[model samples]
Target: MSAATATPARTAPGATTLPVADPAATRRYAWQVLRAHRGGVAAAAVVLLAGAFAGLVPVWLVGRMVDAVASDAAPSRLWWSAAALVVALVGATALAAVARLLVARTFEHALADLRERTVHAALHAPAAHVDGAGTGDLVARVSGDVDVLRTTVSRVLPAVCGAGATILLTVGGLAGLDWRFAVAVLAAVPLQVWGVRTFGRRAGPVFRAERAAAAERTSRVLEAVAAADTIRALGTAETHVHGVEEVSHRAIDRTVAGMRVSLVLTHRLHAAELVALGAVLVAGYGLVGAGAVTVGAATTAALLVHRLFDPVGILLSQVDDLQRAQAALARVVGVLSVPAPAGADAGGAGAEGAGSPAGHATTVPDDRAAATVDVRGVSFAYDPDRPVLHDVDLRVEAGEVVALVGASGAGKSTLARLVTGTVTPTAGTVLVEGEPAGGPRASAAVAAVTQEVHVFAGTLADDLRLARPDADDARLRAALALVGADWVDDLPEGLRTAVGAGGLPLAPDRAQQVALARLALTDARVVVLDEATAEAGSDAARTLDAAARRVLAGRTALVVVHRLDQAARADRIVLLDAGRVVAAGTHDELLAGCEPYARLWSAWHRGRTS
Candidate 1:
């Protein structure tokens, strides 16, 4: 409940962390965005400075009117000062509004460019890096941190710019009225400097910790939500709920600590302002009494010092916001720091730097109609110490469907990912039609569907069109029909029906059908389906299997299957155990000849019958 009661947050050991750009890099990236809009920034600055000066005119006029009354000056002079003061007030308001508009437009353009670059970088980033960092961290960076940065840019940026201009111009006016009035304000400088330095020192680590905690909290919440069904099935909902609460509390604690530091800074700043105001008033009295300056000048000096309170408060409070923004910015820029995997951009055959290491041909060999997958002595490990796959080898000829049958963690999915170019082999090579699995050509040749399918928030046609942007409504319908998604006919709007979040909620089976339909629309010559039907019910499994058969027709395919029936239909079945291919043959051959395969099939049969 209280900031003092909250403890500092600490990261759990082995927690996933996405990259974070250093402070200098963050500043440089920000400068680059600003530099691109320098014309607008310059225009805003000039208008803001002129507005700040215009604001001072009213204070000057009030001081002149005071002198005029004291001296019994002509009434016409009073009228003129009053009229000039009103015009000055009007000009300041108009100029300030224009400056704000300019600032918003400039920063908004920069923010849009940054947002685009961040998304582009995230899309092109290495799959392994993204996976290792976890979806929450990436989502928080791209969505959460980006939003925070956007607010800071749109709101805080303009406010800070205006406040800074007003502060500087007001200080100049104070000196112009009487130099000692400016000197008196310096009495508070030491405290202000100390307060800022202390706040920065204390707030930086806490805010960074707060951000990390927030990311972890987001990751936990996302993980729990994603696995909600599994968690309920396992009767572990309470455990997951507790995990979310624990992380949420950690985030709250860090936030509270940050607030505590900010409060301390605010108090110190207020104290400094009081000291400065007292000194200014004392200087004003001394000057007026000594005949060094008139009462009007003294009043003007006090009024100018008082005017600083609002802008100065804005400047100091924004210091807290600035720290938070910088932290978000560092995370955002960090996304851009992830380098694309080597050869990711190597276009069709013999493109620059497309050649892979010896014994591996990652480049496109030649453009061909039929696609074959070649995995030669390929080994891979998510962790080097714990290899998921060993020196295994396999090949699928064009139009052949090879089912990879294995128990859990047998590297079937890993192999499928390798073939699909989602990952690379640590040793040996994976090639699609003699092109490296991850190279541009091979990537275009391969399309995959896994158990987890996402239906983007859009019309059915828009979702299908992602696979082939040029696909017309006829093609989309054909693809959907080919996948046996008759449910489309039941939809209120057919191909125009909205799906995904905020639209028609699709069942897992229907979503997978959409994914398969998208696959049907692609011209991919190779397909990898990793437990693509694992989530379907028995009835739905048969439907999905039928749809998959139609989609995989005449394609080099690797299907990772848990159900023995799916493997039974494959042209050849590859039974993987541990990290090696223990058996490879037709279903009958494996059942008759391989003890492991026979036992697996017998167990699978028993389970199905039971």
Candidate 2:
């Protein structure tokens, strides 16, 4: 929860690690994703190998044709060899296309599986984890980084494999023709491989820095956009713009540096390749002149040498691509490595071992009725050194409403999160109907309505079904009615009306009502209303307050209210100050006994009347 627990160690100099898709884990996850396309992967590999073989056949045929011509072979044999060369070329081209299509399809299937898992993890990770991980970083991982991986897997890997196999085959063809020429041509490989390795190790870290810089720039840009209004209102637009500019400039500098390294490496390799080709040509001519090799054999060696180095050059050039992919993979693996939230076992013994306490049990007239909540000595913090709540103790009996009153940052919301199971306490425990609060099973008994109510882009019915996926139309309507969201029926499409993004935008009050409707649909026995009515106006607040009381009827409720008038209506009121409970009693009792409560009540009355 404390800033995503710091990113994994930086692999790039002067750049902090960005959570890109994890390469090792992504590769492993990709295989899992690819398991659904095992047949396609196999088929694609076969087609690719066949294409590579065909490509090699052309090189071999050309070498043979060269030998035939040099030896002044019969015209008929020459024509046949030329024809075979043409056929091999055509066959390889055709097979290459087929292999490409197969690989693309397989890659897409794998990408689908990865995207699904990433989205699932993002949604189901604990609130602390999600909140600590910025939205921009996650978006970049999902959209940008994932796309990079998909491209490499679909295009680069297959090409590297096919090209490499063809290059090897071509070299073998040269070797078969004349050993002396083959040896001369093969001498270039060790030099090229060594050069690639030297450049690759240096280039890998540079490319990684370039990628992290890009991610950092992206996160800053997103932050700027999200806070555009605030920045403008605060007269700090220049400051935000400057921050973005700095990040972007850093990214550009890193990218330029990476490219410069690649350019220098390429030039060095090109010089070596040119020298190798020149030596091959000179050696072949000398050997033919000395009668150590026939003219046809010399010509064959010349042609095959070019073929051999073509893939080598290509492989060396793509070292940059490989570096980028590897960096992206590391970022991805970092995210996947975050341990699953505590008490998240959905299978095996842990699920069966879950239990509750006896003190918090509530007798239900019906199985569908609500439960009590018990909190004892709960302490928590986003940072251990700065505790947000210390030894917070509170309880909500069945059918009782408790209101928490506090100034901003006084740990009211932190307590709500603890009770709702969005965050676990650093010490002590929370119990729902005597059950130890852990995981969704315990969370299912608690619902929290916070200041920000997210209305996902979907039909009204789609949004409502999030809380109760199995709920029928009647049940959905009932939940909506309970929250006074019956106005939904008046919309153009009723239950099917679009409600987010490009769809009809709901006023804040209406959005809060929709959230309450979701809470009503949930199986939660204890509802925590944290500033649920803060976004609504006086009239809307009155309507929402009425709806809340009706929907929460006979259910335990913890209301964190800013408006002390509202707190006065609760069956009991608890005052929190600097992360500790200062007082607890009925509103009248607090006014008579607690100075903080009396002062807060006076402020609320004055504000209401004013």
TM-score of each model, paired residue for residue: 0.91, 0.87
lDDT of 2 by residue, 47-133 (tens): 987887788776666667777876788999979988988998999999988987888878777767767766655544555554555
lDDT of 1 by residue, 1-610 (tens): 0001112122333334668887877878877777888999999999999989999999999999999999999999999999999999999999999998899989988888889988877766766667767889989989999898888988998889999999999998999888999999888889889999999998888988898889989999999998989999999999999999999999999999999999998998899899999999999999999999999999899899889988998998789999999989888888887775544554221110111211124322234355888999999876566788888999898899999998899989889878867677889998887878877777767778888888988998887777666678887888888988988989999989998888899998888898888877666677788888884347898888999999888777889998888999999999898999988999999989999989998998888778
CA shift of 322, model 1, Å = 0.5
Clashing pairs in 1: none
Count of clashes, each model: 0, 13
Estimate the TM-score for candidate 2. Answer: 0.87
Per-model CA lDDT versus the true structure: 0.83, 0.73
Top candidate on TM-score is: 1
